[model samples]
Target: MYMNTLRKRSFQIYADHIRPYKGRVFLSWIFLLFAQIIGLVPPLLYKRFVNILSSGTSMDTDISMLVRIILLVVVVYIVMNICYRIAEYVVVHYVARIMADLNQTCFAYLHRHSHQFFSNNFAGALVKKVNRFVNSFRVLFDSFYWDLHGVVVRIIVATCVLAFLNIWLGVILFVWSILFIFVAFLFIKKKLVWDVQKADQDSVVTGVLADTIANETNVKFFVGSSREYARFETETRTQQYLQERSWMVNYWLNVAQGVLLLLVEFCMMYYAVQLWRQGLLTIGDFVLIQSYMFAIIAHVWDVSHIMRRLYEGFADAEEMAEIFETPHEIVDVKRATTLVVPRGEIVFDDVSFQYHATRTIIEQFNLTILPGQRVALVGHSGAGKSTIVKLLLRSHDVTAGKLMIDNQKISHVTLESLWQHVSYVPQDPILFHRTLMENIRYGKPDATDEEVMEAARLAHAHEFIESFPEKYDTYVGERGVKLSGGERQRVAIARAILKNSPILILDEATSSLDSESERLIQDALQNLMKKKTVIVVAHRLSTVMSMDRILVIEEGKIVEDGSHKQLLRKKNGFYKKLWNIQAGTFIM
Candidate 1:
């Protein structure tokens, strides 16, 4: 039942993509039918030529007629080839366009899924699915047009021609062809199960390899290369096993088909001989039966393989079809309006959130930040500080209650519009494998190069960036592994500074910097924060000392809210204790 559903889904995906080009597809099919019909004429002409030659006339006496027959055969073949080429050209041209569209469509749909969906699936697996989905379309279409469609047309034409010449011969070919296809389909049904399994295992192998490569540094640091190798070997071995099992099924199917074809060939030829001896069949009839028999047998043999290719294509496409069918976890509301954050005021009214229903992270959390206020959230690790920031960014929607920005509900606005007004610098910054200039300019795509350099100067990132031989053009390795932790953070800070959005979020953004770098960045941030509403999630007590207000959070709830000086005056308060520990001036 599941396989049946998947088959429908796979074809539907193909249909949707091809619907716009249906006219071209219909035209291609017309050309293909004409080509197949043209291909059948040569076999009939051969039978006629053989009968003429056997009419007891000397070669010299019938030389002109023989020459005419040969010339006609050659003309028929040339026309057949021309039609085949035209059909092929048309099919390939449209299939290429369709495949490219499918690739882009798959990528666009996959990206629309919420953050949670990405968290659950491996990136490598997702990439493989997209490639397979696109490539499988090509495989299935070619098989249908060149192999399956051609074979069907050939069989129908050959059967009709033979039945016209000899009814018994046509009946024998038609019934045997049906039996051959029916048996092949039964094998295909069983092989399809293995094909789907093999496809899934292939994805697993790819995911395992990607995961290992992505974490190559970790494996090297811990000297766990052997362990990773063993893990990868296990996955590959399973893949090999599934591949072999699938191939074995195909092998057995060919064996069964071969036996069927041999029996039919013997029965038909023996019957043809008996009719010839009884004067019921002409020598021409014998030649036609043999020629058509061989043609049908060859085409029938291809049916098993074509069925296998079709099902294999379906198996590959089904994986991505499932992803397309999954609804996006986050979507804009109907008639969603743009988020205009002129004041940058944020309000979290009676908000609550949980990754899972069994364990709540934040419960009934309520807070409001006035426009242009520099509010700091200080808490121990896992105290929901980052969660609060993510909520404000709408990375995950609130489980309950309303989160608004400048009087407009965040959920009521388009996600792109909401994100446009905010600049976020995460604790661990990830950079694309591109030039530093490109990475920095990501904050404001249309920013002038001069503006980018100025932003880098403000974030104190210009010194190291200029030292590289390539300067701003130096490529950052994957995830910016080429840069130190401090350098990546500075680049991230520079990006945020260049953005100059109405609201800024720094979740331990300065944590990775050295003391001197941090001091310089603090100075830069002060200027950047002049009129923007700033929310800082910091563990370091010294960073929040100058904030307008500091909220101490513990276990997902606000434990204290006051200025840094006021919080320090409370001798045993959570903020005060944190301050004392960081300052190394414990009161105990």
Candidate 2:
């Protein structure tokens, strides 16, 4: 039953990645067949040599005939070796090509995952899974062509040759081969547990390394390097333990396989010797049967090892296959069209969102922002402030109500279309490890160098960017780590300025900048926000005091709303209290 399942999975893998190269694979198979035929010819040539020596010189037609037979064998051996190498060369390249394509497919699938999915998993674990999956083909292909396929072909041809000479010997070989395979299959089923455990352990180690690399700065800041090292060591020790156990078990299995091979060879040799004494076989036939017995022993050992390793590799690759089978949480509806937000109006009516069923972040939220209005959301941390932004962005859909842009439901629109009209400068600066020009032009990929510089100038980023030796062409380290806090935020602002979308979200965009830099950025933001629908999420009240509308949200409900002055006039309003707190005063 396991064999059938393994075959189906193997077929699926081949159909997906290897089906395109079937012609090359078929040709390789032909080459292997010719090599095997030439291989079988050697034993026959040795048999012929034995017969010629057994007979007197008078029995042979001439000495010249013997030389001709020896030369034929030499030429055939050379040709067989060439064919074997040719088959190996072609199949190996094909495996590499298929592996490359499979990795690409895996990457494309992973990259499309929803933000929620990424949040739930580690990037390093995912990367390790993909690497293991691509590399599994190496072991899998080796066991497949060299041992599994090779042994099977060797057995069929050997059996045919033996049966043509004597039916009794052929029957014995076939029955023994069946039982040998059955025992090996049973052992392989048990090895699968160790295979899966080791693969899982490998992923854990990789995830630990990835996590540390991603947060090295934080660990150093808190002086927790040694603590992290201990955690990593613990995981590695577990992996080492699994590896040791796996190796010991496979060693014993090989010993058992070795014993089985000996038994089969002894039986074959005894019968061939008996048949020769009874005059049913020639001296040449006796030699051929003995050679065939040794060949059978070698084939059984190879097949046993390959079968176990093949199944183990199949188990490893299937772990990644399960990830591919997971459905995307967010998908565009059938016939969904582009959403055009010409007026930049947004509405969220009775919207509710929750990451878990037991805990709610936003409940029955209702809000509307008119065209070209500057609105601010001010609240303490964990008051559903960011949830509102995520809902409008459709990172996660609202469970209870509709979120619309220009009267079109965001969920019903193509994600690309919805994102096209919105531009965001997040609290933490995000940049790729690419040139400054590339990062700025990311907002609009086709933007020219001059256009990128213009956007940088508008965001007050041009002065600092041009100061570098490479200027706009300078490489920013991973996540813009090479740049200062204020500089990174300015570059992000420059990227957003280049986008120039109708709807803008500034989630603490200036939080990292000093007072002087914030003032410069604030001036640039004023020009950028002119006639644009803007939503600002702020902790520092100074950032939102001049907004056209101030929304003091508490527990996802709008507790206070109006202009900065109008909301402050309310005696018991939440907005008034927060305003006074920021101003270093208290309101009862």
Candidate 3:
């Protein structure tokens, strides 16, 4: 069943990937046919020259005729060569462009996929697949254009010419040609499939090596280098074994082909001698018969190799097509409405969600925040606080009920517009490998330097930022590894401050910071939250103690909601218990 699916998918890829270039492909075929015709003319014209030379005519009498025929052949050869070069150039250029376009389209689709897709596949495998798709076109053309059209067509044309020269020799050579094809196919077909399987196995091994190296830091930290090396060696040995087997099969098949060709050559030579002894055949006729016979036989041999290559091309194409044909699981609604910027009123009416069926996170919860209000969510780990933030951001839609912003259903709004008014700062902030100023500017691309500095000041990041050797020009290493944890957090706050969105979400934003840094960030947060609707997912109990309201979530449900003082007054409440634990007054 898997093999059948792969075969069908291979053909589908050819249809979809190649259909757009049909015009160029057709022109290439036409030029190839013209070149083949011209090539065959040389052999036929040579036979005529041999016949004329054997007539024992005086050279001076036939000089003009010979010269005219030679001149005609020369002219035809020159024209065919020029056309062939032009056609070959165009075909290769078209194929290159098509491969580039195909790679881009595949990558674009990949970019829009949800995070889940990436998590399940190896990064190296994905990269290698795209690279293989790009390289396969050249191989396909080399095996397809020359072998199929050039060699196969030449064989057919030569066969007809041979038959016309002498019926008996033609019949014998034709029988030999058929037998050779059958013999080659018997050995080559199975090996072609084996070769293709070997190639795929090689790609898988390469992908595994890449995936392991990419996460080498984790492996080394865990002291698993020896184990990883052993695993890799095992995979490599398996791939090498398959490759060696494929090579042996192909080598033996070629040997069979060579042996058959030698036998056919000997038999043809015997026929040529027999015909020469008979009165019915002339020297020129024997020459013509032998020339056409060998030409046909050579082309038949070339085509046998091509037939095997066709199978190999199909197999490689199957791997690439599988990736391309995967349907994107998420798609935007047709003509979805854009979410208009509101006064930051948000509502969650009986919302529920689950990343998977067995582990429900948010469940049957209802909440509302009036415009310009600051609301803080406090909870223990696995209390669905982060899930609530994700739902609001529409990273994953709710499984039940409705989420709304200013009474506008979030599902109706376009994802682009919905995110326009939202600004988020995560616990582990991500920073690009760029200068500090450029990184901050990414939050608001059109902001002036002064505007950026103002935002930095607001987030309490500007003082240290300007104190650096390069000031705002300082580079942040990959993932901001060059910056301290507190500094990176501040940088993230500054980015969100620059966005100046009416809606802001802080997801454990101060979890990694020292007490002083957290206090400073809280002060900056106080400033940023003014005149905005703020949803703070707080792990620190002290962070939410001064909020307008607090919601304590547990087991995917909001079990407590009120001002901080009110929740503290309820001694048995979830919020009270959490506060007691954080304050070291209770242990659970």
Provide the RMSD of all predictions against the true structure, rounded to 1 decimal: 2.2, 3.0, 4.2
TM-score, structure 3 vs. true:
0.83
Give the number of the best model, judged by lDDT.
1
Local accuracy of candidate 2 as per-residue lDDT tens digits, 263-373: 778887788778888888888887887787788767877776787778777767776776766788777889999999889999998898877666788888889999999
Candidate maximizing TM-score: 1
Q: For each candidate, what TM-score against the reference?
A: 0.96, 0.93, 0.83
True lDDT of residue 254, candidate 1: 86
Tell me the lDDT of model 1 at 442. Answer: 100
- For residues 1-588, write the lDDT of model 3, one tens digit per residue: 676686686566555778888998899888878888877787666666777888889888567667877988898899889879978887878887777777887688778665567777776777777776656655676787776677667666766776676675667677777787778777777776677777678777887788677667779999989998898898888888877887787788788888988887888778778767876667766666677666776788776677677666666766777766676544467878888865789999999887877778887889999888888888778989888888887767789999999999888887778778899999889898999999898889999999999989888889999889999999998778889888898888999999989999988888878877777777788999999998989878788877898988888788889998999899788888777778862111
Task: Sort the predicted structures by lDDT, highest score first.
Answer: 1, 2, 3
Computed on alpha carbons, the lDDT of every model, listed in order, comes to 0.90, 0.84, 0.80
Candidate 3 Cα outliers beyond 4 Å, as residue runs: 1-14, 17-21, 61-73, 167-207, 279-309, 429-495, 512-520, 542-546, 576-588
lDDT of 2 at 487: 92
* Model 1 misplacement above 4 A: 58-61, 584-588
Worst 10 residues of 2 by lDDT: 579-588
Clashes of each: 0, 0, 0
